[model samples]
Target: MSRKLPIVLGILFCLITNHSISQVIKEVEGLYYNTTGDLYTGTYTEFYESGNKRIEMNLVEGKRNGKITLYFENEKIQEVRSYSDGLMDGTWITWNDNSVKIAEATYKRNKKHGKWYIWDDNGVKRYEMEYSEGEKVGTWYIWDENGNLLKERKF
Candidate 1:
């Protein structure tokens, strides 16, 4: 092989791999883009001033396509949600700073569309609801801190 062949191959490799690896991503109109003005297709992450990860998300073709996670300043996960084509399309969950889950819900095309739940800071479930295309449907239940059902409402 020619000596210059190796040098040319190395430069080509760096250019081809640069976008595939994690690099800073930019969001415009809710879509992600790379510095080269191409649709971003990689993991995007943001960090807190204290050096802890603040958010991490996977993107494909400039749209959020997989799990997106947000964290508290102390590194505890604050929320976890799924997206497809930049819209909420799967299970979404959130927790308090104390690491206790506060809400859980499902979405389809950015609309609430399945069983939903909410809990109090004490880690007790307080509400259980159902949704169909963002409209309340079925029986919704409310509970007290002791887990006793307080009421049920039908739509």
Candidate 2:
């Protein structure tokens, strides 16, 4: 009986340890990526120190392949962008700290492409420009903060 007692205790300890290990695995199974590690496919939510949502991003097969949203510390949306295979490939919108729309731009394969518009903090149009392969290649417009047309230039 004395020898059987040790063996029984050992078996019980093993069972407890194995159960804890499985619990740890379950806790980490949803993590798609860790900052110190390579890419992973998963969704992650990050928070600001003030307990507000700072960013929400999604990953697929270790690459950023979906929408990303960023927020100011006050919880206002700062920017929203979409990515494909880790490259910016769609519309991106940015807002000022006060929640005013500051810019709207388009991207293609990580390069600025198509039309882009900029606005002042007061919500007035500042400029509109077109780009090809990251270079300003078409007509560009400039306007005053009060919506007054200032100039038009062709690049």
Candidate 3:
């Protein structure tokens, strides 16, 4: 074989292998500031090592704004929360790894402001709580997995 032919073949092999390896080595990829205390506008996303989506959120001048969604490594929806101008607002919902609704709560300016519901990992309702601007104000309930009324208390 010609000496020039061997050198060209070696270059081609290195380029192909390096490209594929770089794709996996990139663990964290997103559109954000490169320095601390810097906020980039628009949506930014993160992913798990397995390439599954981890979190996706929006930012306006580096403050949390709009809706944020999180997911499980298995690609299931984990939580969906809303925000306004860097504060938690509107309804927030969460689910289990099995894709079952686990809990839900409301917030206004980052404080709990309304009813909250919770369920066990087996998807059974376990609690119903009320909150007023981060403070409990009314009746709260608890239940067993068999749908039995376990307890009730007023705050």
Candidate 4:
């Protein structure tokens, strides 16, 4: 046998015996789960009935605990969210069907806690707002597609 035979056999064994580690464990109502680790921490993905990816998110202790991505039926990304210990705690972004960014915001424990921006499908800035713990604060600006300020307000 070649010197590399043992290594190759070991890899083959792992591939055959551990395939379940990456296999989807469950599917219910169009959702699929793939988990590993002692705590079963891994990614869980859901598919739309149209066969497009609906959502893909990480799970820690079976709770949403990491980056989450959502997709439209056309396979375009619709939104991206981050979670820590099952609560939203980081950047969140959304895009329109045309792939133009529609909104971007930051969250701390599922609450809007930072600057938020909105744009139209034509990629024109529409609004900008500030928030603290989900409450609107500071100044906000609204503009038209023609780059004209439609309104401005201070909270």
**TM-score versus the correct structure, for each prediction:** 0.82, 0.74, 0.76, 0.73
| CA displacement after TM-score superposition, residue 101 of candidate 1 (Å) | 1.1
Better of 1 and 2 by TM-score: 1
In order, the Cα lDDT scores of the candidates are 0.90, 0.80, 0.81, 0.81
- State the weakest 10-residue window (summed lDDT) of model 4: 29-38
lDDT of 4 by residue, 1-155 (tens): 69899999998886664454336555433333445323446776666655467888887765678789999998899999999887889999999999999899999998999999998888888999999999999999999999799999999
TM-score of model 4 (CA atoms): 0.73
- For all predictions, the C-alpha RMSD in Å is 7.0, 10.7, 7.1, 6.8
- Who is ahead in TM-score, 3 or 4? 3
Superpose all Cα atoms of candidate 2 onto the true structure and report the RMSD in Å to 1 decimal: 10.7
Q: In model 1, where do residues sit more than 4 Å from their true spots? A: 1-23
Model 2, span 1-155: residue lDDT tens: 99899999998996685554333221234334444465456775666655577877777866667799999998899999998987899999999998899999999999999999999998898999999989988889999977888999999
What overall lDDT, based on C-alpha atoms, would model 4 receive against the true structure?
0.81
Indicate the residue-level lDDT of 51 in model 2.
Answer: 54
In angstroms, the error of model 1 at 14 is 19
Worst 10 residues of 3 by lDDT: 22-31
Give every collision pair in model 1: none
Top of the candidates by TM-score = 1
Of models 3 and 4, which has the larger lDDT? 3
Task: Give lDDT: candidate 4, residue 82.
Answer: 92
Across 14-116, the per-residue lDDT of candidate 1 in tens digits comes to: 6565544335577899888988899999888877656577898999999998899999999999999999988999999999999999999999999999999
